[model samples]
Target: MTDMRVSIAGVKFKNPILVASGTFGFGHEYGKFYDLSELGGICVKGTTLHKRDGNPAPRIAETPSGILNSVGLQNPGVDAFCAEEMPFLKRFDTKIVANISGNTLEEYSELAEKVAAAGVDMIEVNISCPNVKAGGLAFGTSCTSAAAATEAVKNHAGSVPVMVKLSPNVTDITEIARAVEAAGADALSLINTLLGMRIDLKTRRPILKNNTGGLSGPAVLPVAVRMVWQVANAVKLPLLGMGGVASGADAAELMFAGASAVAVGTALFNDPYAPIRVRDELAEYCENAGVARVSELTGGVKPW
Candidate 1:
Protein backbone atom coordinates (compact mmCIF):
# COMPACT_ATOMS: atom_id res chain seq x y z
CA MET A 1 0.00 0.00 0.00
CA THR A 2 1.21 3.51 -0.76
CA ASP A 3 1.94 5.56 2.33
CA MET A 4 -0.11 8.75 2.11
CA ARG A 5 0.91 10.26 5.42
CA VAL A 6 3.03 13.44 5.40
CA SER A 7 4.31 15.59 8.23
CA ILE A 8 4.87 19.35 8.24
CA ALA A 9 6.87 20.77 11.12
CA GLY A 10 6.10 17.58 13.09
CA VAL A 11 2.32 17.77 12.47
CA LYS A 12 1.26 14.60 10.68
CA PHE A 13 -1.46 14.68 8.04
CA LYS A 14 -3.15 11.51 6.90
CA ASN A 15 -2.61 12.64 3.31
CA PRO A 16 -1.37 15.69 1.42
CA ILE A 17 -4.79 17.10 0.48
CA LEU A 18 -6.10 20.02 2.54
CA VAL A 19 -8.92 22.51 1.89
CA ALA A 20 -7.75 26.10 1.67
CA SER A 21 -8.91 28.87 3.96
CA GLY A 22 -11.86 31.11 3.01
CA THR A 23 -13.14 28.30 0.80
CA PHE A 24 -13.66 25.62 3.43
CA GLY A 25 -15.32 27.91 6.00
CA PHE A 26 -14.50 25.88 9.15
CA GLY A 27 -15.55 22.63 7.37
CA HIS A 28 -19.16 22.81 8.59
CA GLU A 29 -21.04 22.60 5.30
CA TYR A 30 -18.53 20.23 3.73
CA GLY A 31 -18.53 17.99 6.78
CA LYS A 32 -22.13 17.03 5.96
CA PHE A 33 -20.98 15.73 2.59
CA TYR A 34 -18.37 13.37 4.01
CA ASP A 35 -16.35 12.67 7.07
CA LEU A 36 -13.92 15.59 7.48
CA SER A 37 -11.38 13.09 8.78
CA GLU A 38 -11.05 11.58 5.33
CA LEU A 39 -8.77 14.35 4.12
CA GLY A 40 -5.35 15.44 5.36
CA GLY A 41 -6.19 18.74 7.00
CA ILE A 42 -8.49 21.76 6.93
CA CYS A 43 -7.15 25.35 6.86
CA VAL A 44 -10.14 27.14 8.35
CA LYS A 45 -11.45 30.49 7.15
CA GLY A 46 -9.31 33.60 7.64
CA THR A 47 -10.13 34.77 11.16
CA THR A 48 -9.32 38.23 12.44
CA LEU A 49 -8.98 39.81 15.91
CA HIS A 50 -12.49 41.26 15.68
CA LYS A 51 -15.64 40.73 13.67
CA ARG A 52 -15.59 42.21 10.18
CA ASP A 53 -18.58 42.96 7.97
CA GLY A 54 -16.32 42.38 4.94
CA ASN A 55 -16.35 44.40 1.73
CA PRO A 56 -19.48 45.74 0.04
CA ALA A 57 -21.85 43.47 -1.85
CA PRO A 58 -21.05 41.95 -5.27
CA ARG A 59 -17.71 40.90 -3.80
CA ILE A 60 -17.34 37.99 -6.24
CA ALA A 61 -16.95 37.96 -10.01
CA GLU A 62 -16.56 35.12 -12.47
CA THR A 63 -13.67 35.28 -14.89
CA PRO A 64 -12.71 33.07 -17.83
CA SER A 65 -11.28 30.16 -15.85
CA GLY A 66 -11.46 31.46 -12.30
CA ILE A 67 -13.14 33.87 -9.92
CA LEU A 68 -12.06 37.14 -8.35
CA ASN A 69 -13.02 37.89 -4.77
CA SER A 70 -12.65 40.75 -2.33
CA VAL A 71 -14.45 39.28 0.65
CA GLY A 72 -12.33 41.44 2.91
CA LEU A 73 -11.83 38.74 5.53
CA GLN A 74 -15.40 38.43 6.82
CA ASN A 75 -15.22 36.36 9.99
CA PRO A 76 -16.57 35.93 13.52
CA GLY A 77 -13.33 37.11 15.12
CA VAL A 78 -10.70 35.09 17.02
CA ASP A 79 -12.58 34.95 20.30
CA ALA A 80 -15.66 33.40 18.69
CA PHE A 81 -13.53 30.93 16.77
CA CYS A 82 -11.89 29.68 19.95
CA ALA A 83 -15.11 29.53 21.89
CA GLU A 84 -17.40 28.12 19.19
CA GLU A 85 -15.72 26.90 15.98
CA MET A 86 -12.80 25.11 17.56
CA PRO A 87 -14.99 22.63 19.44
CA PHE A 88 -16.83 21.59 16.27
CA LEU A 89 -13.58 21.14 14.31
CA LYS A 90 -11.97 19.24 17.19
CA ARG A 91 -14.49 16.45 16.64
CA PHE A 92 -12.80 15.49 13.40
CA ASP A 93 -9.65 13.41 13.25
CA THR A 94 -8.02 15.64 10.62
CA LYS A 95 -5.59 18.38 11.54
CA ILE A 96 -7.06 21.84 12.21
CA VAL A 97 -4.97 24.76 10.93
CA ALA A 98 -6.27 28.14 12.06
CA ASN A 99 -5.71 30.67 9.26
CA ILE A 100 -5.42 34.06 10.93
CA SER A 101 -5.12 37.61 9.53
CA GLY A 102 -4.57 40.96 11.19
CA ASN A 103 -4.13 44.63 10.39
CA THR A 104 -1.43 45.20 13.01
CA LEU A 105 1.43 43.34 14.66
CA GLU A 106 -0.26 43.40 18.06
CA GLU A 107 -3.41 41.91 16.58
CA TYR A 108 -1.48 39.10 14.91
CA SER A 109 0.36 38.25 18.12
CA GLU A 110 -2.84 38.22 20.13
CA LEU A 111 -4.68 36.08 17.61
CA ALA A 112 -1.82 33.59 17.50
CA GLU A 113 -1.71 33.31 21.28
CA LYS A 114 -5.45 32.71 21.66
CA VAL A 115 -5.72 30.15 18.86
CA ALA A 116 -2.62 28.26 19.95
CA ALA A 117 -3.84 28.28 23.52
CA ALA A 118 -7.19 26.98 22.27
CA GLY A 119 -5.33 23.87 20.94
CA VAL A 120 -5.24 24.17 17.17
CA ASP A 121 -2.94 21.66 15.48
CA MET A 122 -1.23 24.48 13.55
CA ILE A 123 -1.47 28.20 12.70
CA GLU A 124 -1.42 29.50 9.12
CA VAL A 125 -0.59 33.23 9.17
CA ASN A 126 -2.24 35.20 6.34
CA ILE A 127 0.19 38.06 5.77
CA SER A 128 -1.62 39.08 2.60
CA CYS A 129 -3.87 41.29 4.70
CA PRO A 130 -2.76 44.91 4.62
CA ASN A 131 -0.58 46.11 7.49
CA VAL A 132 -2.41 49.18 8.77
CA LYS A 133 0.76 50.43 10.43
CA ALA A 134 2.73 50.25 7.19
CA GLY A 135 0.58 52.65 5.20
CA GLY A 136 -1.65 49.79 4.02
CA LEU A 137 1.15 47.80 2.37
CA ALA A 138 0.68 44.03 2.56
CA PHE A 139 3.06 42.47 5.02
CA GLY A 140 3.83 39.63 2.59
CA THR A 141 4.99 42.13 -0.06
CA SER A 142 8.19 43.09 1.79
CA CYS A 143 10.83 40.93 3.45
CA THR A 144 11.18 43.20 6.48
CA SER A 145 7.45 43.44 7.18
CA ALA A 146 6.92 39.73 6.54
CA ALA A 147 9.68 38.77 8.96
CA ALA A 148 8.40 41.17 11.53
CA ALA A 149 4.92 39.68 11.39
CA THR A 150 6.30 36.17 11.60
CA GLU A 151 8.44 37.12 14.59
CA ALA A 152 5.50 38.65 16.40
CA VAL A 153 3.39 35.52 15.93
CA LYS A 154 6.26 33.25 16.94
CA ASN A 155 6.71 35.16 20.17
CA HIS A 156 3.19 34.26 21.26
CA ALA A 157 2.19 31.09 19.40
CA GLY A 158 3.71 29.01 22.18
CA SER A 159 4.53 25.50 20.88
CA VAL A 160 2.03 25.52 18.00
CA PRO A 161 3.70 25.36 14.60
CA VAL A 162 3.44 28.65 12.69
CA MET A 163 3.13 28.38 8.90
CA VAL A 164 3.42 31.72 7.07
CA LYS A 165 1.31 32.07 3.91
CA LEU A 166 3.12 34.07 1.18
CA SER A 167 1.37 36.38 -1.26
CA PRO A 168 2.03 36.28 -5.01
CA ASN A 169 1.75 40.04 -5.55
CA VAL A 170 5.40 40.56 -4.59
CA THR A 171 8.21 40.81 -7.14
CA ASP A 172 10.42 38.20 -5.44
CA ILE A 173 8.59 35.57 -3.41
CA THR A 174 11.86 33.85 -2.56
CA GLU A 175 13.05 36.89 -0.64
CA ILE A 176 9.87 36.85 1.43
CA ALA A 177 10.12 33.09 1.97
CA ARG A 178 13.69 33.32 3.21
CA ALA A 179 12.75 36.22 5.46
CA VAL A 180 9.92 34.32 7.16
CA GLU A 181 12.04 31.19 7.53
CA ALA A 182 14.69 33.23 9.29
CA ALA A 183 12.03 34.71 11.54
CA GLY A 184 11.18 31.28 13.03
CA ALA A 185 8.31 30.14 10.78
CA ASP A 186 8.03 26.37 11.09
CA ALA A 187 6.58 25.89 7.59
CA LEU A 188 5.32 27.94 4.62
CA SER A 189 2.23 28.06 2.38
CA LEU A 190 2.56 29.90 -0.89
CA ILE A 191 0.80 31.43 -3.90
CA ASN A 192 -2.01 33.16 -2.10
CA THR A 193 -4.46 34.68 -4.65
CA LEU A 194 -2.86 36.92 -7.28
CA LEU A 195 -4.13 40.49 -7.64
CA GLY A 196 -6.62 40.83 -10.48
CA MET A 197 -9.78 42.65 -11.61
CA ARG A 198 -12.48 42.77 -14.28
CA ILE A 199 -14.82 45.42 -15.66
CA ASP A 200 -18.26 45.52 -17.22
CA LEU A 201 -17.99 46.75 -20.79
CA LYS A 202 -21.38 48.46 -20.88
CA THR A 203 -21.29 49.96 -17.39
CA ARG A 204 -17.65 51.03 -17.87
CA ARG A 205 -16.97 50.05 -14.31
CA PRO A 206 -15.42 47.18 -12.30
CA ILE A 207 -17.38 43.98 -11.81
CA LEU A 208 -16.55 43.38 -8.19
CA LYS A 209 -17.76 45.96 -5.71
CA ASN A 210 -14.22 46.28 -4.31
CA ASN A 211 -12.89 47.26 -7.78
CA THR A 212 -9.89 44.90 -7.46
CA GLY A 213 -9.93 41.37 -6.11
CA GLY A 214 -7.72 38.34 -5.67
CA LEU A 215 -7.85 35.83 -8.54
CA SER A 216 -7.98 32.12 -7.74
CA GLY A 217 -8.70 28.99 -9.83
CA PRO A 218 -7.09 26.85 -12.52
CA ALA A 219 -5.86 30.13 -13.99
CA VAL A 220 -3.22 30.45 -11.27
CA LEU A 221 -1.98 26.82 -11.28
CA PRO A 222 1.11 27.45 -13.35
CA VAL A 223 2.14 30.40 -11.20
CA ALA A 224 1.47 28.45 -8.04
CA VAL A 225 3.61 25.51 -9.17
CA ARG A 226 6.48 27.81 -10.19
CA MET A 227 6.41 29.72 -6.90
CA VAL A 228 6.27 26.52 -4.87
CA TRP A 229 9.30 25.21 -6.75
CA GLN A 230 11.23 28.42 -6.20
CA VAL A 231 10.32 28.80 -2.53
CA ALA A 232 11.06 25.13 -1.85
CA ASN A 233 14.63 25.70 -3.08
CA ALA A 234 14.97 28.95 -1.13
CA VAL A 235 13.99 27.65 2.29
CA LYS A 236 14.42 24.56 4.43
CA LEU A 237 10.85 24.70 5.77
CA PRO A 238 8.11 22.43 4.48
CA LEU A 239 5.55 23.98 2.14
CA LEU A 240 1.76 23.67 1.94
CA GLY A 241 1.15 24.52 -1.72
CA MET A 242 -2.11 26.07 -2.94
CA GLY A 243 -3.71 28.11 -5.76
CA GLY A 244 -5.76 26.16 -8.30
CA VAL A 245 -5.60 22.52 -7.29
CA ALA A 246 -8.66 20.69 -8.66
CA SER A 247 -7.66 17.13 -9.50
CA GLY A 248 -5.34 14.37 -8.33
CA ALA A 249 -2.95 15.12 -11.17
CA ASP A 250 -2.84 18.78 -10.13
CA ALA A 251 -2.02 17.75 -6.58
CA ALA A 252 0.74 15.45 -7.84
CA GLU A 253 2.12 18.20 -10.04
CA LEU A 254 2.33 20.56 -7.09
CA MET A 255 3.97 17.85 -5.01
CA PHE A 256 6.51 17.20 -7.75
CA ALA A 257 7.14 20.91 -7.94
CA GLY A 258 8.04 20.86 -4.21
CA ALA A 259 4.89 21.00 -2.08
CA SER A 260 5.03 18.76 0.98
CA ALA A 261 1.21 19.04 0.92
CA VAL A 262 -1.46 20.71 -1.23
CA ALA A 263 -4.71 22.61 -0.64
CA VAL A 264 -7.93 22.77 -2.70
CA GLY A 265 -9.54 26.20 -2.90
CA THR A 266 -11.93 27.45 -5.59
CA ALA A 267 -12.61 23.88 -6.67
CA LEU A 268 -14.57 23.39 -3.48
CA PHE A 269 -17.11 25.95 -4.64
CA ASN A 270 -18.10 23.60 -7.47
CA ASP A 271 -17.60 20.25 -5.77
CA PRO A 272 -17.70 19.79 -2.04
CA TYR A 273 -16.09 16.37 -2.44
CA ALA A 274 -13.04 17.69 -4.28
CA PRO A 275 -10.70 17.05 -1.39
CA ILE A 276 -11.75 13.41 -1.03
CA ARG A 277 -11.62 12.86 -4.77
CA VAL A 278 -8.15 14.41 -4.94
CA ARG A 279 -6.94 12.23 -2.10
CA ASP A 280 -8.22 9.05 -3.74
CA GLU A 281 -6.88 10.06 -7.12
CA LEU A 282 -3.50 10.86 -5.62
CA ALA A 283 -3.37 7.41 -4.05
CA GLU A 284 -4.22 5.85 -7.39
CA TYR A 285 -1.48 7.92 -9.03
CA CYS A 286 1.13 6.69 -6.58
CA GLU A 287 0.03 3.11 -7.11
CA ASN A 288 0.18 3.44 -10.88
CA ALA A 289 3.66 5.02 -10.77
CA GLY A 290 4.91 2.16 -8.59
CA VAL A 291 5.69 4.65 -5.83
CA ALA A 292 5.27 3.16 -2.37
CA ARG A 293 4.98 6.49 -0.62
CA VAL A 294 3.39 9.83 -1.57
CA SER A 295 5.88 11.90 0.42
CA GLU A 296 8.58 10.77 -2.03
CA LEU A 297 6.95 13.01 -4.68
CA THR A 298 7.89 16.25 -2.98
CA GLY A 299 10.55 18.19 -4.94
CA GLY A 300 10.71 15.23 -7.33
CA VAL A 301 10.64 17.28 -10.51
CA LYS A 302 13.54 16.98 -12.94
CA PRO A 303 14.87 19.96 -14.90
CA TRP A 304 15.64 19.48 -18.57
Candidate 2:
Protein backbone atom coordinates (compact mmCIF):
# COMPACT_ATOMS: atom_id res chain seq x y z
CA MET A 1 0.00 0.00 0.00
CA THR A 2 1.22 3.48 -0.73
CA ASP A 3 1.92 5.62 2.32
CA MET A 4 0.16 8.89 1.70
CA ARG A 5 1.34 10.52 4.89
CA VAL A 6 3.87 13.40 4.76
CA SER A 7 5.25 15.77 7.36
CA ILE A 8 5.88 19.50 6.89
CA ALA A 9 7.58 21.61 9.53
CA GLY A 10 7.11 18.69 11.98
CA VAL A 11 3.33 18.52 11.35
CA LYS A 12 2.31 15.20 9.81
CA PHE A 13 -0.52 15.19 7.32
CA LYS A 14 -2.49 12.00 6.73
CA ASN A 15 -2.37 12.73 3.03
CA PRO A 16 -1.02 15.38 0.69
CA ILE A 17 -4.37 16.83 -0.35
CA LEU A 18 -5.49 19.90 1.59
CA VAL A 19 -8.32 22.33 0.89
CA ALA A 20 -6.89 25.74 0.13
CA SER A 21 -7.85 28.73 2.25
CA GLY A 22 -10.75 30.96 1.13
CA THR A 23 -12.11 27.96 -0.76
CA PHE A 24 -12.93 25.73 2.23
CA GLY A 25 -14.46 28.50 4.35
CA PHE A 26 -13.72 26.89 7.78
CA GLY A 27 -14.89 23.50 6.34
CA HIS A 28 -18.36 23.70 7.90
CA GLU A 29 -20.22 23.78 4.59
CA TYR A 30 -18.10 21.07 2.98
CA GLY A 31 -18.25 18.95 6.16
CA LYS A 32 -21.96 18.36 5.53
CA PHE A 33 -21.11 16.68 2.22
CA TYR A 34 -18.42 14.38 3.63
CA ASP A 35 -16.41 13.75 6.76
CA LEU A 36 -13.77 16.47 7.07
CA SER A 37 -11.45 13.88 8.58
CA GLU A 38 -11.25 12.09 5.23
CA LEU A 39 -8.75 14.68 3.98
CA GLY A 40 -5.27 15.53 5.25
CA GLY A 41 -5.72 19.16 6.35
CA ILE A 42 -7.96 22.20 6.08
CA CYS A 43 -6.87 25.83 5.57
CA VAL A 44 -9.57 28.05 6.97
CA LYS A 45 -10.60 31.25 5.18
CA GLY A 46 -8.27 34.24 5.46
CA THR A 47 -8.91 36.04 8.73
CA THR A 48 -7.83 39.48 9.93
CA LEU A 49 -7.62 41.12 13.37
CA HIS A 50 -11.15 42.39 12.87
CA LYS A 51 -14.21 41.45 10.85
CA ARG A 52 -14.36 42.59 7.23
CA ASP A 53 -17.42 42.84 4.95
CA GLY A 54 -15.27 42.20 1.88
CA ASN A 55 -15.51 43.76 -1.59
CA PRO A 56 -18.70 45.23 -3.01
CA ALA A 57 -21.17 43.45 -5.27
CA PRO A 58 -19.97 41.51 -8.36
CA ARG A 59 -16.83 40.29 -6.67
CA ILE A 60 -16.63 37.14 -8.85
CA ALA A 61 -16.26 36.72 -12.60
CA GLU A 62 -16.12 33.42 -14.45
CA THR A 63 -13.36 33.30 -17.05
CA PRO A 64 -12.62 30.72 -19.74
CA SER A 65 -10.97 28.01 -17.66
CA GLY A 66 -10.76 29.85 -14.35
CA ILE A 67 -12.48 32.45 -12.21
CA LEU A 68 -11.56 35.92 -10.99
CA ASN A 69 -12.32 36.97 -7.45
CA SER A 70 -11.97 40.05 -5.28
CA VAL A 71 -13.32 38.61 -2.03
CA GLY A 72 -11.11 40.95 -0.01
CA LEU A 73 -10.51 38.63 2.96
CA GLN A 74 -14.01 38.62 4.32
CA ASN A 75 -14.17 36.87 7.69
CA PRO A 76 -15.45 36.99 11.28
CA GLY A 77 -12.09 38.23 12.59
CA VAL A 78 -9.43 36.49 14.74
CA ASP A 79 -11.40 36.67 18.01
CA ALA A 80 -14.53 35.18 16.46
CA PHE A 81 -12.54 32.42 14.75
CA CYS A 82 -11.00 31.34 18.06
CA ALA A 83 -14.20 31.81 20.03
CA GLU A 84 -16.66 30.24 17.58
CA GLU A 85 -14.92 28.54 14.68
CA MET A 86 -12.29 26.58 16.60
CA PRO A 87 -14.87 24.48 18.44
CA PHE A 88 -16.33 23.27 15.16
CA LEU A 89 -12.89 22.66 13.60
CA LYS A 90 -11.44 20.92 16.69
CA ARG A 91 -14.02 18.14 16.45
CA PHE A 92 -12.29 16.90 13.31
CA ASP A 93 -9.07 14.86 13.37
CA THR A 94 -7.50 16.77 10.48
CA LYS A 95 -4.75 19.39 10.75
CA ILE A 96 -6.01 22.98 10.84
CA VAL A 97 -4.06 25.90 9.34
CA ALA A 98 -5.13 29.45 10.02
CA ASN A 99 -4.54 31.70 6.96
CA ILE A 100 -3.93 35.15 8.40
CA SER A 101 -3.59 38.53 6.65
CA GLY A 102 -2.93 42.04 7.86
CA ASN A 103 -2.66 45.57 6.56
CA THR A 104 0.54 46.21 8.50
CA LEU A 105 3.42 44.36 10.19
CA GLU A 106 2.02 45.00 13.68
CA GLU A 107 -1.36 43.68 12.62
CA TYR A 108 0.23 40.53 11.24
CA SER A 109 2.05 39.97 14.56
CA GLU A 110 -1.12 40.54 16.55
CA LEU A 111 -3.14 38.13 14.43
CA ALA A 112 -0.43 35.49 14.61
CA GLU A 113 -0.14 35.80 18.41
CA LYS A 114 -3.89 35.52 18.92
CA VAL A 115 -4.35 32.54 16.59
CA ALA A 116 -1.27 30.78 17.95
CA ALA A 117 -2.53 31.19 21.52
CA ALA A 118 -5.88 29.81 20.40
CA GLY A 119 -4.20 26.48 19.49
CA VAL A 120 -3.93 26.15 15.73
CA ASP A 121 -1.65 23.56 14.14
CA MET A 122 -0.07 26.16 11.86
CA ILE A 123 -0.26 29.79 10.82
CA GLU A 124 -0.11 30.69 7.09
CA VAL A 125 0.98 34.33 6.87
CA ASN A 126 -0.72 35.70 3.73
CA ILE A 127 1.72 38.41 2.76
CA SER A 128 0.23 38.39 -0.72
CA CYS A 129 -2.43 40.67 0.70
CA PRO A 130 -2.25 44.23 -0.65
CA ASN A 131 -0.45 46.28 1.98
CA VAL A 132 -2.66 49.27 2.67
CA LYS A 133 0.13 50.88 4.62
CA ALA A 134 2.34 50.72 1.54
CA GLY A 135 -0.23 52.25 -0.77
CA GLY A 136 -1.65 48.92 -2.02
CA LEU A 137 1.67 47.30 -2.87
CA ALA A 138 1.26 43.60 -2.10
CA PHE A 139 3.60 42.59 0.72
CA GLY A 140 4.73 39.54 -1.27
CA THR A 141 5.74 41.73 -4.19
CA SER A 142 8.93 42.85 -2.46
CA CYS A 143 11.67 41.02 -0.53
CA THR A 144 11.73 43.60 2.25
CA SER A 145 7.99 43.52 2.94
CA ALA A 146 7.78 39.74 2.64
CA ALA A 147 10.70 39.20 4.99
CA ALA A 148 9.34 41.75 7.42
CA ALA A 149 5.95 40.01 7.49
CA THR A 150 7.53 36.61 8.03
CA GLU A 151 9.82 37.90 10.78
CA ALA A 152 6.98 39.64 12.62
CA VAL A 153 4.76 36.57 12.53
CA LYS A 154 7.58 34.31 13.66
CA ASN A 155 8.27 36.52 16.66
CA HIS A 156 4.67 36.42 17.88
CA ALA A 157 3.38 33.07 16.57
CA GLY A 158 4.91 31.21 19.57
CA SER A 159 5.31 27.48 18.80
CA VAL A 160 2.80 27.24 15.97
CA PRO A 161 4.73 26.71 12.74
CA VAL A 162 4.51 29.69 10.37
CA MET A 163 4.06 29.25 6.61
CA VAL A 164 4.39 32.24 4.32
CA LYS A 165 2.06 32.17 1.29
CA LEU A 166 3.80 33.68 -1.75
CA SER A 167 2.11 35.67 -4.48
CA PRO A 168 2.74 34.93 -8.17
CA ASN A 169 2.43 38.57 -9.20
CA VAL A 170 6.14 39.21 -8.94
CA THR A 171 9.20 39.38 -11.20
CA ASP A 172 11.19 36.72 -9.34
CA ILE A 173 9.38 34.32 -6.97
CA THR A 174 12.67 32.68 -6.02
CA GLU A 175 13.98 35.92 -4.51
CA ILE A 176 10.87 36.24 -2.35
CA ALA A 177 11.02 32.56 -1.39
CA ARG A 178 14.64 32.82 -0.28
CA ALA A 179 13.86 36.02 1.62
CA VAL A 180 11.04 34.41 3.62
CA GLU A 181 13.13 31.32 4.29
CA ALA A 182 15.86 33.56 5.68
CA ALA A 183 13.34 35.50 7.78
CA GLY A 184 12.47 32.23 9.57
CA ALA A 185 9.41 30.84 7.82
CA ASP A 186 8.83 27.21 8.72
CA ALA A 187 7.16 26.37 5.39
CA LEU A 188 5.80 27.99 2.23
CA SER A 189 2.67 27.98 0.04
CA LEU A 190 2.83 29.46 -3.42
CA ILE A 191 1.03 30.79 -6.53
CA ASN A 192 -1.74 32.76 -4.99
CA THR A 193 -4.18 34.02 -7.71
CA LEU A 194 -2.72 35.88 -10.70
CA LEU A 195 -4.04 39.36 -11.33
CA GLY A 196 -6.66 39.43 -14.12
CA MET A 197 -9.58 41.38 -15.48
CA ARG A 198 -12.75 40.72 -17.50
CA ILE A 199 -14.59 43.50 -19.23
CA ASP A 200 -18.13 43.63 -20.59
CA LEU A 201 -17.91 44.62 -24.25
CA LYS A 202 -21.47 45.93 -24.31
CA THR A 203 -21.08 48.07 -21.21
CA ARG A 204 -17.35 48.56 -21.68
CA ARG A 205 -16.81 48.05 -17.96
CA PRO A 206 -15.03 45.49 -15.79
CA ILE A 207 -17.09 42.53 -14.62
CA LEU A 208 -15.73 42.43 -11.08
CA LYS A 209 -16.40 45.36 -8.80
CA ASN A 210 -12.71 45.67 -8.00
CA ASN A 211 -12.07 46.05 -11.78
CA THR A 212 -9.20 43.53 -11.68
CA GLY A 213 -9.19 40.41 -9.50
CA GLY A 214 -7.07 37.36 -8.68
CA LEU A 215 -7.34 34.61 -11.29
CA SER A 216 -7.51 30.97 -10.22
CA GLY A 217 -8.40 27.57 -11.76
CA PRO A 218 -7.16 25.26 -14.53
CA ALA A 219 -5.98 28.24 -16.51
CA VAL A 220 -3.26 28.93 -13.96
CA LEU A 221 -2.07 25.32 -13.59
CA PRO A 222 0.98 25.63 -15.84
CA VAL A 223 2.03 28.87 -14.19
CA ALA A 224 1.58 27.31 -10.75
CA VAL A 225 3.72 24.34 -11.68
CA ARG A 226 6.47 26.55 -13.07
CA MET A 227 6.51 28.77 -9.98
CA VAL A 228 6.44 25.77 -7.60
CA TRP A 229 9.39 24.23 -9.42
CA GLN A 230 11.36 27.46 -9.14
CA VAL A 231 10.61 28.07 -5.47
CA ALA A 232 11.20 24.43 -4.52
CA ASN A 233 14.75 24.56 -5.87
CA ALA A 234 15.40 27.97 -4.31
CA VAL A 235 14.43 27.25 -0.70
CA LYS A 236 14.56 24.31 1.71
CA LEU A 237 11.12 24.95 3.17
CA PRO A 238 8.32 22.51 2.34
CA LEU A 239 5.85 23.97 -0.15
CA LEU A 240 2.05 23.86 -0.18
CA GLY A 241 1.51 24.14 -3.97
CA MET A 242 -1.67 25.58 -5.35
CA GLY A 243 -3.22 27.71 -8.13
CA GLY A 244 -5.66 25.86 -10.48
CA VAL A 245 -5.35 22.31 -9.12
CA ALA A 246 -8.45 20.31 -10.19
CA SER A 247 -7.63 16.61 -10.63
CA GLY A 248 -5.32 13.84 -9.43
CA ALA A 249 -3.04 14.23 -12.43
CA ASP A 250 -2.91 17.93 -11.67
CA ALA A 251 -1.95 17.20 -8.08
CA ALA A 252 0.73 14.79 -9.24
CA GLU A 253 2.14 17.42 -11.57
CA LEU A 254 2.54 19.85 -8.70
CA MET A 255 4.09 17.16 -6.48
CA PHE A 256 6.54 16.15 -9.18
CA ALA A 257 7.38 19.78 -9.68
CA GLY A 258 8.35 19.99 -5.95
CA ALA A 259 5.35 20.69 -3.71
CA SER A 260 5.54 18.76 -0.44
CA ALA A 261 1.73 18.81 -0.61
CA VAL A 262 -0.95 20.14 -2.94
CA ALA A 263 -3.94 22.39 -2.30
CA VAL A 264 -7.30 22.37 -4.17
CA GLY A 265 -8.83 25.81 -4.49
CA THR A 266 -11.23 27.18 -7.16
CA ALA A 267 -12.24 23.65 -8.11
CA LEU A 268 -14.23 23.43 -4.86
CA PHE A 269 -16.82 25.85 -6.20
CA ASN A 270 -17.83 23.45 -9.01
CA ASP A 271 -17.44 20.28 -6.93
CA PRO A 272 -17.50 20.21 -3.17
CA TYR A 273 -16.13 16.62 -3.08
CA ALA A 274 -12.97 17.65 -4.98
CA PRO A 275 -10.54 17.08 -2.10
CA ILE A 276 -11.67 13.49 -1.48
CA ARG A 277 -11.87 12.74 -5.18
CA VAL A 278 -8.38 14.11 -5.75
CA ARG A 279 -7.00 12.07 -2.83
CA ASP A 280 -8.56 8.87 -4.16
CA GLU A 281 -7.32 9.56 -7.66
CA LEU A 282 -3.84 10.29 -6.35
CA ALA A 283 -3.84 6.96 -4.50
CA GLU A 284 -4.85 5.22 -7.67
CA TYR A 285 -2.04 6.97 -9.51
CA CYS A 286 0.54 5.77 -6.98
CA GLU A 287 -0.82 2.21 -7.06
CA ASN A 288 -0.68 2.07 -10.85
CA ALA A 289 2.84 3.47 -10.90
CA GLY A 290 4.10 0.91 -8.31
CA VAL A 291 5.27 3.67 -5.99
CA ALA A 292 5.53 2.63 -2.34
CA ARG A 293 5.12 6.09 -0.84
CA VAL A 294 3.38 9.12 -2.29
CA SER A 295 5.91 11.49 -0.77
CA GLU A 296 8.48 10.00 -3.14
CA LEU A 297 6.90 12.05 -5.93
CA THR A 298 8.15 15.31 -4.47
CA GLY A 299 10.76 16.82 -6.82
CA GLY A 300 10.67 13.59 -8.84
CA VAL A 301 10.99 15.38 -12.15
CA LYS A 302 14.23 14.87 -14.08
CA PRO A 303 15.94 16.93 -16.74
CA TRP A 304 15.80 15.94 -20.40
How many residue pairs in model 2 have overlapping backbones? 0
TM-scores for every predicted model: 0.97, 0.97
lDDT, candidates in the order shown: 0.91, 0.91
> lDDT by residue for model 1 over 90-153, one digit each (tens)?
9999999998887889988999999999999999999974312231237888899899999999
> Can you tell me which runs of candidate 2 are displaced by over 4 Å?
130-137
Score candidate 1 by lDDT. Answer: 0.91
Model 2 Cα lDDT, one tens digit per residue, 1-304: 8999988899999999999999999888999999999989999999989898888869899999999888888899999999999989999999999999888899999999999988999999887753123312368889999999999999999999999999888999999999999999999998888888999999999998878888999999999999999999999999999989999999999999999899998999999989999999999999999989999999998946
Candidate 2 vs. true structure, TM-score:
0.97
